[model samples]
Target: MPFKTLLFSKQDTIAVITLNRPPMNALNSKVYKELGKVIDELNEDSSVKVVIVTGAGEKAFAAGADITEMVNLSTTEMHEFCLISQDAYNKFEQLNKPTIAAINGLALGGGCELAMTCDFRLASENARFGQPEINLGIIPGGGGTQRLPRLIGLARAKELLYLGDMIDAVTAEKYGLVNKVVKQSELMNEAMAMAKKLASKPAVAMKVLKNTVNNGVEMNITSATNFETNSFLVTFSSEDRLEGMKALLEKRKPNFSDK
Candidate 1:
């Protein structure tokens, strides 16, 4: 299937989804619809061990939502739009494989919300981040209000939301908004390299590892620990676990079948 608002490609076990609305991949109805479709396909793709998301061109990952298309929307329509957008983003957030947002440029408004959905973010030196919807007399319609504080601290999330100011990649890293910052020229290369490394690991273990953290974080300590213990036992019963332990004793590399 062809996409009207995005570009999708696969490299071995890695799938790359680029927001493709030119210099600024502004989120609009088309983008949201296409993104939902893409994510559905990726979710069903067993061969894809990791997913990397970035924006086309150099100037912006996604400047923001498309205001021109949104300016005249009725309150009811806006509500529906927000739900559609959030649904698509949430699907990507819950994808079984690990996801990395390669933030190459400005990731403001909905872009910032999108990045927070990823397992982690790798930003280029030129990357700038913000939740500037307040500048337009609105607030974040996506998951920013919920996810931002969870990623950073409460105070920092408040500052970004209230002030609606853009922060440089270094500042974003300092605030724990991004994992690392790299040269703009090296962003894709570095993202692909990291994705490939993750791809080579035992897929079942990776899935279980992600599930342990994501599911455990929302529970009380005792409940979370119990969940983790049960998850560990689940993995302990896998063929890959046996192979991994046997390989360690045998002094050989383990070839996991993702079982």
Candidate 2:
């Protein structure tokens, strides 16, 4: 299906999703709806082992939510709106395939929240990140408050949230908000390179790794270790594992079927 607010393309095992709202790519209800649909499509496509998300232009990954569309909502309407946004983003975070956020420019407010949902974030030198909802007399209704602290640290997350300030890509990298900062011109190339590398890994094991880490973080050490043990057993049963081990002894690269 075609999308009104997104551009989607697939090259080999990688799928790229571009937020298409012009200039700043301010996410609105339409964008969120289309994003949910796109995520659904990618989730069901077995051939797509990795997904890369970016914006239409170099100016912004997404500046934020569409303020014009959000400013007049009643309290109840706002609650429903937040729930809708959360649902869409949650689907992205829980996707079966790994996702990479290629942040080319400004990623603010809900934009920052969206980036956090991805498995990895590769930011360009021109990229700026922040949770600036406080300046608008509101808090981050997205997962910012929850995920930010977990990604960086409580002190740093609070500082950014309380100050409503934007950090440069280098600063973001130092704070652990981004995996790496590349030149703006090379952002997409770097993202595609990383995506291809991830695609080449054992698919079943990769999925299990993502599941374990995401779920384990919220569990106690004892329970998390037990969960990891179960996950290990599950991966051990895969044909890829047998092939991997056999290939090691045979002195050749393993051809994983993702079984």
Candidate 3:
């Protein structure tokens, strides 16, 4: 399908979704819907081992939500709109496959929330991030309040949200907001390179690993370990496991079937 606000393409096992609106790709209802569609495709397609989300241009990953639309929204309308966007983000987070957020530039407010939803975050040296929603007399309604704390720490999350200050890429990386920061020119190359590396690994194992790691964080330690152990056992029962073992025995690279 043709996308209105984003570009979706696959290379080998990586699916890249570029937020196509120029300058800073601010989120809109259309953008959210388009993203939701692509996210759904990533979830259902076995060939898609990883997904990379980024903005089209160098200005921003996403500046924030479309505040122009927000001006007209009543409290109820605002809730509905935020829910739509949050639902898309929730879908992205729940995806069994791994996802990497390519923070190309300024990732503020809902933009920051979007990146936090992903499994990993890689930022360009020119990137910036923050939850600057309070300046507008509002709080982030799109999972920021909850996710930021979990990502960094409660104190750090509170400091960022309370002050609504934007931080540089390097600072963000130090605080655990971003995974790594590279030169602007190397941004896409680095993201795709990492995606390719992850794609080369056993796809089914990555899915199971991602699920156990992500879900385990919310559960107690004992339950989480049990869940992970169960996943370990489950993988050994798969065709990919057999191939991985046989390939090791034959002294060759394993070719996974994602089964």
Candidate models: Cα lDDT each: 0.93, 0.95, 0.90
Judge candidate 2 at residue 35 and give its lDDT: 85
Across 47-155, the per-residue lDDT of candidate 1 in tens digits comes to 9999999999999999889999899999999999999999988998888899999998899999999999999799999999999999999999989999999999999
lDDT (10s digit) by residue, model 2, range 40-99 = 888888899999999989899999999999999999988888988998899999999899
* Residue range 1-259, candidate 3, lDDT tens digits: 5898998888887888998878889998888888888788777888788899999888999999998888999999988898889989999998878899999889999899999999999999999999999999989989999999999999999999999999999999999999999999998899999999898888778888888888899999999989989999988888999999999999999988778
TM-score ranking from best to worst? 2, 1, 3
Q: After superposition, how far is residue 4 of candidate 1 from its true place, in Å?
A: 0.6
Clashes of each: 0, 0, 0
TM-score: which is higher, 2 or 3?
2
The TM-score that candidate 3 achieves is 0.97
lDDT of 3: 0.90
Which model scores highest in lDDT?
2
lDDT of 1: 0.93
- Report the error of model 2 at residue 253, Å: 0.3
Report the poorest 10 consecutive residues by lDDT, candidate 1.
1-10
